[model samples]
Target: MTPASPTPPDASRRSRGSIRKTACCLHRGYPVDQLARQCDFLEVAYIMLNGDAPDEASYQTFRETITRHTLVHEQIARMCSGFRRDSHPMALMCALVGALAAFYHDVLDVENPQHRALAATRLLSKMPTIAAMSYKYTIEQPAAYPRNDLSYAGNFLQMLFAIPAEKYVLNPVIEQAMNQILVLHADHGQCASTTTVRAAGSSGANLFACVAAGLASLWGPMHGGANESSMRMLEEIESVDQVPAFLRQAKRDPQAFRRLGFGNSRYRHRDPRADILRETSHRVLAEVGMSDRLLQVAMALEDVALTDPYFVDNGLSPSVDFYTAVILKAMNLPSSMFAVVTAVGRTVGWVAHWNEMHQAPLTIYRPRQIYVGEGYRDYVSRRGERSAELR
Candidate 1:
């Protein structure tokens, strides 16, 4: 796939409007690289949901308010317990998030500005808890509660990794890297998911409904599941030496041995988030000092993909998903959890877009389609098949 050239923004509105511009792979007006380097996810999320950056007092208040809502209702856990233990985390995440609407009725009044803010805060805060708990449900491990003392990413790591009986310390390096990942993915203009949220919100569906609709759209492998597929691809390669053979197969039979995690419909030359995560992935692998062969394979694969003529000719530069798989693997996260983690990062974007849609003159989204079927065919009924006219 050829990468897309940056589309100049509609200057009069100052909005990128879609993923093609994505504010130029930037958020608001702040460059994503700057936000990834300088700001925490919560602060960046604050800036996104609100028009202005928060002052010291406002930021503290915002962070504290969000932290207060991280814990979900007890029944949410009981509901999760009923699912088969083999359930994928992404499926669990989507189901649990949709279930939130039943629990959070007070925040349903989207017309009320206060209610909108509260709804966004609740989703943003509780998403980590929900995502972590979903993973625990799959593993049949006891779910961990949110910790107030930890930063946003630190709390997530603790909830996923910490056992009450065992003292688990939070590592700053890991937490910072995780926060960057979250911030980098917080928004990317519009998508099938974000558009779903917009359409739902236009009809005054509450935050959970809007976000749930969005998440369901994101569940496909071509969308939020790319990182998971990328991880699976690396695992298939197994050893560094096998990467060349895999590439050869990919080049020969592109459809049968598909390539992923490279190229984008957004950036023309490189994915900005990929640039950020490439460096972060290295830092994480070195800091964790893991002998994980998959990371080694990823390193080799990345090198080949960057240099290979086939990839370069197709403008198949590594996208964020490429290194995201590497980073998550280094953190010992399973491939199954990759999309779940993506949902965690994307909740902010979903909420932000939903909020924006409500703020504007709302219009319900109806997809435009071109008919491609055999047109003007006479209705015919055969054996068991009923004609449309009968209905």
Candidate 2:
């Protein structure tokens, strides 16, 4: 079983909005930025769930444990086959992830600690497999089996791109980019999806169901599609030369062409995650061996945002979303799979938070709200004249 405290691991110094303003609140003693850049995805997840980095021996066992569960049941593969060929990958993922709980329904006693640990491990391992299956199904291709020999991220890439005839020889650059991408997005404190996961988990739902809720939350463009939107914004600018004209329009009518990916409430200055991703963006692009015009446009925008007085004064800097779009584009993944991929990375966090939420006494989350609607009004049926006048 995964090593963890019986109670939810304490956030070292988590303030209400600290993570939104700057770097992640310390996980136990480790800063997440350092973990994202240097460690593998599972290593970072171990830290998040266990409250400390694993020793060499412990990590080996942990790694083996994670890999052992990577393969979803054959029934899941057959189940994925039932989806429409044109279904969105996220839609497919949301459905099948929830379906996974049905197969394991016998042991879903959420109160059992070992059961919770098993559930967490299963989810951390299975989500990528499901995501890859969803992608393959969308493209009318067969799903690839998970490789025990590959690292977590490497296996995911292989499952995603490897075909029957040509085995995917893992490229170091590609694998490194994939690993960092997963690590970088593994967690950001209490985002919409994470909150949804916790809220669902608080209600005594199974892990798969809670995580599926998180997946559904991420399906919306506002949360999960920002990077894709960033790509769109960059594409609209087309060539680097067109950025100036686009900026002029943005300046004249801010609402007409809203600039995305330049800033967020999460970081007042440079997003530390963006800095880490930027360090490797060029390397991945070079490895991709294609001149991506949209990536060029993104960098052009980055340059302007960095030096422009307007952007500087407003604290508008490039964000993690923009760099993600650049790297995923260079890696040649479809926009449809972008959010699905991100959710795969973030499953670690979702699981970690759920584990934490269930540590002590579990309470179904109940948020109080004041009623502001018309009060003590008689029911307005269609027969009423006012009801006939308006909805």
Candidate 3:
């Protein structure tokens, strides 16, 4: 008998697994690290959406457009007030954004460029306000309204830190650091949250609902909450001296150890964002005149992990989450607020990807999976007969 022909390669599997070209490059095709060093969040957002850096006239218009939409409807604020004070900020944000569809159905037209633009601007502007409102609601503080006179980052800082009967000055260092964080996180190609956004948008869903889906996906610990987990891990370590023991424990049972921010799935080398954030974290911490033991432990842990043979061999390195926890902590933001901050920055990326998907010729996203299970068999209604068949 002739030998059986070799099995044909699974083209579907290969195609599904293959890496595609990335289209989220910053202005002039600069890398994110370089872009983070040069541009603020608004400029970066403009570049991501428009495929070019904005000129002076366009930049002013873009900034003004976003500023105009910073205030949400009074009903949305009342809706946020209904959530329990202890509710997770991200959960509140997801609900609020989803509810945006109910209030702004006129701008849900994906086929209309003007409607899409307005929707994007509204989301980008109001997300920070919504995030800050969530925080104030959780702490039972009266919501501090947005100040359009301030820069975007400055306005967010005011909303978060300003309170009645006190003038809160925006520190230049903190404002710059916050802007850098937002710009660096503005877009990463097909990240979990972005993929979620795209998948939802594939159904021709309203922009607000699609973005709300992305926010929900980002609430997972493995994604946007990495910084919060990383902060918690650092706090647990408590001191630099304990980092060695922590590392040893991690080596033994990684699953139980929960190394939150040391590695990234897509970045094999040091994450470009981490480098910029490290510098910014140090600068901000020093400027604030803060000396945090947890920050020290985090730094030492990163140092040891980078030098350890096991981590080096396994391609594990500091990711953006590593230093971001420290930076946010230095800014006096609670660990609970970390993911909300991430969502605030990532909203632009979600909007950009949603627009891209809507404008493309792509159909609805329906991924196939390989089934490795028992073949079809007769259904036995009786439990006794089913058990006997199994035996």
Per-residue lDDT tens digits of candidate 1, residues 221-250?
Answer: 888888888988887886898988888877
**lDDT winner:** 1
TM-score per model over all chains? 0.90, 0.90, 0.89
| Clash number for each model | 0, 1, 0
The positional error of residue 19 in candidate 1, measured at the CA in angstroms, is 6.4
User: Sorted on lDDT, highest at the top, how do the candidates line up?
Assistant: 1, 3, 2
- Tens digit per residue, CA lDDT, model 3, 1-391: 3454498623211111112133123333656776788877888888778777889999999999999899999899999767888999998999999999899888988878899988998999999999999999998898999998998888998999999989989999999899888877776666788888878887788899999999999999888998899988888886788889888888887543435887665655566677788889889978976567877787798788779998766656667887888889989899999999989988887787777765655477766556798998766755657744776
| Candidate 2 wrongly placed segments (more than 4 Å) | 1-25, 252-259, 380-391
Clashes in model 2: which pairs?
20-266
In angstroms, give how far residue 294 of model 1 lies from its true place. 0.7
Error of 1 at 196 (Å): 1.8
Q: Against the unseen true structure, what C-alpha lDDT does each candidate score?
A: 0.82, 0.80, 0.81
Instruction: Assess candidate 1 and give its lDDT.
Output: 0.82
- Cα error of candidate 2 at position 141, Å: 1.7
Candidate 2, residues 1-391, lDDT tens digits: the string is: 3444478534421212114435543544566577777899889888878878899998999999999998888998898768789999998899899998998886478889999999888889898899999999989888999999999999999999999998689998989888988987887788899889888987789999999999999877777777777777877786999988877666665433333666666666777888788877878877776467887887788788778887666666677887888888888888788899899988988888888876667766665566687856646666665654665
- Mind sharing the TM-score for model 2? 0.90
